[model samples]
Target: MKAPPPNILFFLTDNQRNDLLGCAGNPIIKTPNIDRLAASGVRFENAFCTSPICAASRASYLTGTSEKRHRFTFLTSPLQSAYTDISYPATLKMAGYRTGLIGKFGIATNGIVPSLQDEDAVEKMFDVFDNYEHWTEEGYEIRQPDGSVRHLTDITGDKTINFLRTHQSDHPGQPFCLSVSFNAPHAQDNDPRCYIWPATEDHLYAETQIPEPFNAHPDFFRQLPKFLRETESRVRWQKRYATSEDYQRNMRGLYRMVSGVDRNIGRILGTMDQLSLSNNTVIIFASDHGMYYGDRGLSDCWQLNEQSIRIPLIILDPRADENNRGLIREELALNIDIAPTILELANLNVSDKMQGKSLVPLLEKKKVDWRKAFFCEHRFHRADIPKSEGVRTQRWKYIRYYEQQPVYEELYDLRNDPHESFNLAGDHRFSNHLKRLRRRCDKMSAECA
Candidate 1:
């Protein structure tokens, strides 16, 4: 007999890198729940976000397209209605799945950034929507009857648990796709006390010393061009990493925030098991993009480097064979591939308009021809942030800032210099290699556009 469609529990985090969890080899962060999930599932070692910023990357994850195709960034208005129509949630709803979204739907729409009060816009996509932000300083949503405030991460877990309980009671036979987006570990840009965490997690990494970034030396910052040195990335770095004291305080806060989120994930997974849904639920955990801690003296994500673009992706299908459990895949995965994966898992056809390919074959261990390289772009043009595009292959990367005066380019051979410390673009010995990659970048950009 054919099995019923599996439920989906998609978890997303903001400003989290590919190596922040315990399973990813970070010794300090406490993420036992996520680590266990990775141990029982498939972890993609080379997952990346096409755009290394929040709004654009989140839109790409929802719409299954490149940021160049979606065109929703800081410079643009809300995401277009056409893209949302093909989104995974909307498509799953059309296929009779109960859909819910909790916490931090960061994509803007309808001429304004959405809040929890915006029901009309959210209803078209999610049947149950609860949207909020970091709320570390001013705004908050949940207050206990005892007059104590709940942290946003805790509130997110509560909402997800409520959805599962309600679904079991009301729609016992129907499957659900619940998306939980956590706004933890992302620095409150306006506040000087950046990277705030729940008070409950204050003791997580109190005494542990965070190792200094390998590229935190002044020489690395000196290697950057004047335009990049003057950008907002550097300004943000000054606020968080200007001194050793500030770096220690902020890094500990970041670690605690991540641990807080991990704690809530444990609660959510426990609820799924208690409700007898674990055997039929597929959980996908990932982040919108990555963060930088003094890497090249930068603190935020916008550049095309590994620290900014690489993100963690874990998929756990409980129905898969026991032998296939805990498998790791090395194929390159992108945020855009998420929508198509969800659609295929739900037994729907991937839209021709979607640029991402479904990862079902990879999950099933099928021999297939995969992409050798993928194109990445950032279009959030500002005085501090410049527009740029690039192509990243397995062994090489080429980035060009077309908007810069005289057009600056950067090339790195990833095989030898995995840290991307040396630029080979200007070397006469690699002129032919540079020319080849430049042409490839241009061709891929045009095709993606």
Candidate 2:
């Protein structure tokens, strides 16, 4: 008889940067569990989100399509059923995988959630869905039947462990897929605390000082284009990083929240070991998108800059050879590639409609021709957020704000200016390079559409 399909466990964190974890070479953060996971798996050094926002990026992860193809972003109408019906969870369920979702179901379907009453619609996607959002206004308290209050992060871990236990008890023979999406590390946005973590993590970085952000000086803020300087990113910067004290507190809080999530990941892995499931499970850890901790005088993610788009991506399959362990791949992996990767891991064929390619071959160390670069875009139209798209290659990044009166453009030589401190679009010497990138950007936008 053929061997049973491996169980899949996926963990997605909110607003986390690629360099925060110890495994990613950050010297200050406490993420031991995640670091251990990275040491045993393949970590993608250059993973990015096509759209650097929750709604669009999460939708891309689910549907294996770009935001341009899926057309789902904040304040937009609910995602079309055609796309939701083909979501990774839905497809895995159809293929005999018992799927479960815990924490923030960021996408809306047929209705915006917390107001969405259609239980049948959600049931079609996840067999066990515990959907929620960040506890911004009221704080992160969930009273249990025992009269004890628990943090939202702890409750999320409880639910995940409970899912593993219940699955083992109810469906011992069936392989499962569990998605644990954590709302930690994302700022409250409305709360003055900005970033909140469990009290347990209050002392993680109590004495260490956070380094000054890239281009954090007032001169950098003054030099920005008027449209960008007046945007919400700057508004949030005032709220979170207006002072050195504010910057230190908020950055430490974000790292503490990340450490809190790391603790829970340890709990989940422990549960897998206790249940004898460690040998047959594949685990993936990533974030929807990266956050800007006052990078370039920005607070939240909206622009296609490195700090806003780069995310942490790690995949560990227990069946892989020992040589593949601890390997770090400097490949250009996108959030959209996740669904296809999960499907391929379960021995299912990837759909033609899915724009992303499977990452299984990369994990196996197979000699496959991989993408050298990828398309990135942000189409959310708002006064504070501009509508723009771009093409990012190994050494260059070209962005265009098509909605601008004169269509403003930006070009960065990523090789020399990885921080993207200088704009090369106006430089006459790189005119040919600019023209080539512009045409490539247009062609990519068309292809994705």
Candidate 3:
């Protein structure tokens, strides 16, 4: 009998920063389970999202295409069925894999309030789809089958475990793909407390002193362009980080939410081990996009800053040779690459329409000519957020706000100014360098379009 393919477990978190994990060198945040996953898998040291917003990045991850190609951005836009049909989950399902999706699927929220009615089309992509949107009041108010309300993270973990157990019983010889998306660490915009987590996690970082980033200072906020200084970012900063107490409260709440999610992940990992599925299951951990914890006086993740664009990517393929296990790669990885990687892992061919290249070569430690740079873009979300695009190379980053009058630009030598503190776009000393990057950015933007 031919052996079935390996099972896939993908965990996607919301509004998580790259530096949140203990393995990522943060001394404070507790992420033992994720750190364990990293210890047993390959961690990409510099993974970034193609788009910094929730819907666009999630779409990119599904279709393995850029935002320009997917044509889904903004809060009220629904991802086209055409794209969803070709999405990784849909493709995997077509290829005879039992696919399940749990937790928050951000791409289906097209109206003022996320409705299950609107998700009827996208729900067909998965075999066992639980399309829950915790961002909405109705979605968050849902109770478990036991008649007890729980945190969204706990509910998601329970659903994931149930799905795994059911799949094991119904299809012991068949492979399955399960996607668990958790809406954690993302601030509750409608809640009075802003950030919400389990009550048990209230003391996770209570006594710890959370240091503010350098850009959170008023002077740094003043240094921004007039448009940025007046954008919704500044308003959110005022609400979350204007005062020391507010900063600490919000930061601690955010960390607590993350810790809560991590605990649920630990439970999932334990279940996998108990079921003896750990060895044959390929595990992936990542976020939709990075978040800004009061960086640049910004409280959200619309900007092209490093804190907003960079995300954590860890992949554990049990089939990998010993030499590649627990290896850390410095090459750039993007959210769009996720689909191709999963398809490659299933021993399937990648679609030509996918702009992302598979990371299988890197996981296998094979010699390949990788990309030199990648382009990222942000379309207008609100009146406060301007449309912008940029190209990031290993040593430099160039951002241009095309919608703004006079065309604002930012050029940062990432090697020298990793925090993006200095914008050398207007400096005559680097005129040639800036000009080259601008042309490169323009060319890449055109190609992506």
Candidate 4:
């Protein structure tokens, strides 16, 4: 027999990487809360986000489907809600759990929220948590990648803590699903100085000495294929908000952002424990996607490098789930898996329409024959840029483009070329391997479509 469902505490940070924290092996980041969580629960070393853009990636995370299927492919575009079917919160509410969201709701379901169409669903999903309305001042500017200036991490953290305290006293024993989505260190926001970091200007040199990975020459574009280089060149100039010391300064800021977010997580977790919600509540910490902290001469990631799409996913299931409490699953897992996992853990029936498989059984050691590969993609962002997709296996990564008349693609043998500098897509040495990956991506696309 199954134990009663525990409350859900989901934490999400923006533009984060799996390798940025001290627990994940980065000595420079100071993330004690996340480190503590990693020590006590399952740490998925190969977690990947379905996409990199804030809108598309978030849409996938929320709906348990891909961008192409959700049709909310870019930030400003409206979403087609039915394609992905039931959301994590909506499903939980249907199963008798109270639901609430804190911080930024990145995937704005256009003007109307069909999932929240019922009065109960709307109240269950949005009634408890506070977003920018009360969190920010009337005249304060909303941060943008091109011109951002507010210190959002502190504000976001405070607001999240407050929301939890309010609800902590409201429902003493009933089960609930509460999620806090945070924006930190993302490249699209305004200028870079508004966000705080751990290392100051004086300590930058000693701190960021790891140096840029492949494409060692930030100027390696001249050798790239024509259409591919054109997109890379413009992306290079924007600098993705890292302006001072090339990739080094960008990375220093990134490390600062992750460490800062970690501190906030510590605050929220501490409050939960104080309220006695920690022991029974399940805590999940992850990012929308990984960051490109100067890897492959790529400061901002829209690529398939390990540092780009792979992010940190740590699941701290309730005290009683027992099977593999502190285990690490090497299975290839992606973002869509999260929605269904949350649903299944709450004792809700995972909708057949859900493209993701739940992670509960894997946590309980019941899923021995899991998946072999994870599929992801980015579509129609810059009108001039092409649609892109990535396939991640245990040791290989392939990213292809639908840009010109011919498909322009990139393939990397992770064991030999982890930095992903050389494009082996057209190389004769690995044609068979590349073809196999392309076929898998096509099948996933057809399934989602």
Highest TM-score, which number? Answer: 2
Question: What lDDT would candidate 1 get against the real structure?
Answer: 0.87
**CA lDDT for candidate 2:** 0.89
**Candidate 3 lDDT by residue in tens digits, 1-449:** 95558899999999898998899998999989999888888999999998999888988998899988877776645667666767788888888888888977777446333222235545556888686666677443466688976888788888898888888888887789899999887887777688888876877998999988757778888889999988887888888888999999988888888899899999998998888899899999999999788898887888898999999999999877788888888999999999999998888778888899898888866666898899999984688887889999999999999888899999999999999999999999999999999999989988897
In candidate 2, the residue pairs with backbone N, CA or C atoms under 3 Å apart (3 or more residues apart, or in different chains) clash, namely none
Tell me how many residue pairs clash in candidate 1: 0
Candidate 1: residue 386 Cα off by (Å): 1.2
Stretches of model 4 off by over 4 angstroms after superposition: 1-3, 75-77, 83-85, 109-124, 133-150, 192-210, 232-246, 320-323, 365-367
Count of residue pairs whose backbone atoms collide, per candidate? 0, 0, 0, 7
Model 4, 1-449: lDDT tens digits are: 95667888888887787887777887666778898897788888778887876667777777788776777754344555453338787677667777777666665543223322233434544446454321233112345577854456666777777766776787666788887887665643334343344332224434555444445454674666666555652465446433446555555666666767787788888888788878778888888887555444345556556776888898888674556677888787778899988987777787777778888766755457887777777774575455678677777787887665687777888878766767788889899999988887788767777
Question: By summed lDDT, which 10 consecutive residues of candidate 2 come out lowest?
Answer: 109-118
User: Which sequence of candidate numbers ranks them by TM-score, best first?
Assistant: 2, 1, 3, 4
In candidate 1, which residue ranges exceed 4 Å CA deviation?
A: 109-112, 115-121, 135-145
- lDDT, candidate 3, residue 203? 75
The TM-scores, one per candidate, come to 0.96, 0.97, 0.95, 0.85
State how far residue 75 of model 3 sits from its true place (Å).
Answer: 4.9
lDDT of 2 by residue, 152-173 (tens): 8887999999999999999998
Whose lDDT is greatest here?
2
